[model samples]
Target: MFKDLLKTHLFPTSWCPGCGIGGIMAQLAMAMDEMGLNQSNSVVVGGIGCTGRMAGYFNLDSVYTLHGRTLPVAQGIKMVNPSLKVIIISGDGDLASIGGNHLIHALRRNVDLAVLCNNNEVYGLTGGQAGPTTPQGTPTVSSPDGSPYEPLNLQGLLKTGSRYFYARTTVYHQVHLKRCIKEAIQWPGFAFVDIASQCIENNGRRLGFKTGYEMLAMFRDKYKRAPDGVESLAPLEIGLVKRGEEQP
Candidate 1:
């Protein structure tokens, strides 16, 4: 019965074949189930783009906010109904670009909500443009000559503003992803889980990867590990480079 609630008719989604977004949705639903959060107590907030469509699929209350404004909308929901468990789902461009301010401010205020950032490294829904997290030298429709700028370190940036529980996971690591979401949901203050999803049709093809699963596998091979100091290695590193602090 609990699992049935997580199923969404949105299957055979618009996302490209093997897109990691579906895996992310599954993990989130599983986490909610494990935490015993039902539709009555849960509310999903989302911004524009493929990630934003998650609001339509979730069985719980949802608000499909304007582009890059999910966090602010989520804040309002939490403020009015403190008992509701709010989860904000957004894409890379939505969260780290136009909505960047809202993302950081939400962390500063330490609002009681969970953030699930699907970092696909490109603006998938918008004709495959180079997004804020696009790595250097990655070719995109906007960057025909390859993007020159460095990618934003999402986990590190989030750690600088708030003291909330933070974790970074990938669709490849299903167990870790599920565990991270569960932990973030349980944390009292604002919690964030940056999911390294794959835009197979956009970023993947540009990088010579055939499918989203391949991209997820690459992330697992390269950056799969917990941050240092904790008994368990976090999915990715957190915190900024302090003046005298040792780098993780």
Candidate 2:
């Protein structure tokens, strides 16, 4: 039933215990339920990454595609059936790194879809390597001495007239996550929600957070909401980067 939304048989998912992915999944399920989405007409498209696995746990119709390819696939599905509600869920590495081109164009074209980007900083599925979103000075498998490059500002990248709607939230704030998801789903054009999820097995350990709860608390401590009402990513205020304004 939509009330539960999850497939109990898939209980004990592959994600590590206390992983924030579960919280994001629950919020997603609840968002759909609140929206009264029809399972047959709602689609969850995922790419090859830890977040991609989200498509399999839900009872709704879902499609799993190659790494960084979720956006194009979801776009095609939306084109074929405009009535269907399409959602692209994947890790930051999958969407903002390798598949960044597709993401930029899709939003620029005003494609009717929702994107849920799980930003765990490092590439959790690929041996804890530093990804495009990994902050500078954070050590990873690829950068044991700490990453030298500054993290990519994905939300800022979308600030140019391309993005129709955008929001930021963390798994620690599940209620806000659901509310953002609900708003994004209801938006008429392209919508993006960047979820600062935690990778307890990798990122947390590397960053010195021994447990998932500590990581969650860290997020709660770090994140703040901008005065404009959209959630912020630390001091960056990612959600309102270009709220109601466009770049030249």
Candidate 3:
């Protein structure tokens, strides 16, 4: 059934062998499949990055927007046809860097949109540059010595709104990742799902990881779900946080 949601003819996506973007795409497709979402009711908007290519693979209508413009475009689409479901897929750099101003306004407006950010931490497509979400001291092509700045506080930023929905999950956590996508799609207002994913050929190798599987193993060991009812999540915890008409 999930295969029906994908343009399987586009098999062997440009994403590198063992790249986590493929995993994110598959899981998202599966989630959409389970949700009864299709070409008639939904659209996927992608940004400029490896993750942006995901939009092309979806069987549903998709928009390939300019760098960092996915949000505003998605917002426009939502505003024009409030009945259609708009979902955005983009990388950390696209969303947190160039598109940051839009991210803030989108959160403040609490528009009915679902954003799935592939937080791989580095700009994988453009020669592995340090991105906004790249952790401090992480080595990259641009930061040969290591990134000197702290990563963006996405959780804190998302939580700034009076009513918000944020969920954190990693690509390695298959079940959780799909669940996060599904729930975010169902959330009434703006929903952001920060998906910690691997950029094996770029970020992973620079971090001394031998393979994508190794990176995945590290995620499996390093992250865990927070207890239910927690107001906020810690750096290593993965869970949902909401403040709206219904309790978190």
Candidate 4:
């Protein structure tokens, strides 16, 4: 049933070998299927980037908008129908760089939508440049010497801008990723999920990760959650940090 809804022709295609976006897409499809949302009432808004292509690959209503413009477009769609299940699939560069202002405003307004950010660190669509979320000292095409500025903590950033359903998951954590997407869709008001993805062709080569699967494994091991209040747990963690107003 889940496979029936996927746009299979879009597969065996563009994304680099081992890219995590495909897994994220699968999780989304599963979530939608579980929720019983069909093409008639579902709309996906994608911005310019690798993630943006999601609009074309789903068997549902979709709009491929300009770079960083998907948030507003999704918001507009929700305003027009209000009943439609709107989802925004965007990349770190498109969402945090070009579309950052819109993202923040949409969160501040608590618009009804689910925002999925494919955060691969570097901008993959455009020649592996240093994006807004690029880690400090990570060298990229544009930052050959190393990215001087600190990377933005999207989860932390949104915490200050709005109190909404927020979560950070990765393709490596399939179960958690699926649950996060489902919760984001079920939550009323604006919800954001930052999927820490892997860009095999670009980031993997630069970081010596060898393959996309290796990158996913690294993320899984490094970011996995520890037991609550466990002493000396990993410094980084992933999961829901906030919940918004109940649906009216």
Best by lDDT: 3
Task: Return the TM-score for each candidate structure.
Answer: 0.89, 0.92, 0.98, 0.94
Off by over 4 Å in 2: 1-3, 229-248
Stretch of 10 with least lDDT, candidate 1: 239-248
Q: Ranking by TM-score, best first?
A: 3, 4, 2, 1
Backbone clash pairs for candidate 4 read none
Candidate 4 residue 186 Cα shift, in angstroms, is 0.7
- Model 3: per-residue Cα lDDT at residue 37: 92
State the lDDT of candidate 3 residue by residue for 154-202, as single tens digits.
Answer: 9999999799999999999989999999999999899999999999998
lDDT of 2 by residue, 1-42 (tens): 454667868788889897888888888888898788857779
Candidate 3 TM-score, C-alpha based: 0.98
For all candidates, the clash counts are 3, 0, 0, 0
Q: What range of 10 consecutive residues in model 2 has the weakest lDDT sum?
A: 239-248
Model 2, position 180: C-alpha lDDT score? 86
Estimate every model's Cα lDDT from 0 to 1: 0.79, 0.83, 0.93, 0.84
Tell me how far the alpha carbon of residue 16 in candidate 3 is from the true structure, in angstroms, after superposition. 0.3
* Prediction 3 global C-alpha lDDT: 0.93
lDDT for each residue of candidate 4 in 1-248, tens digit (9 for 90 to 100)? 77766789777757878988999888999999999987888988899999899888888878999988998888888999999999888899998899989978998888888988898999998879999999999999999999999997686667764366677788899898998898888788888898889998877789888898899889878897644333222335667766436444
Q: Which candidate leads the pack in TM-score?
A: 3
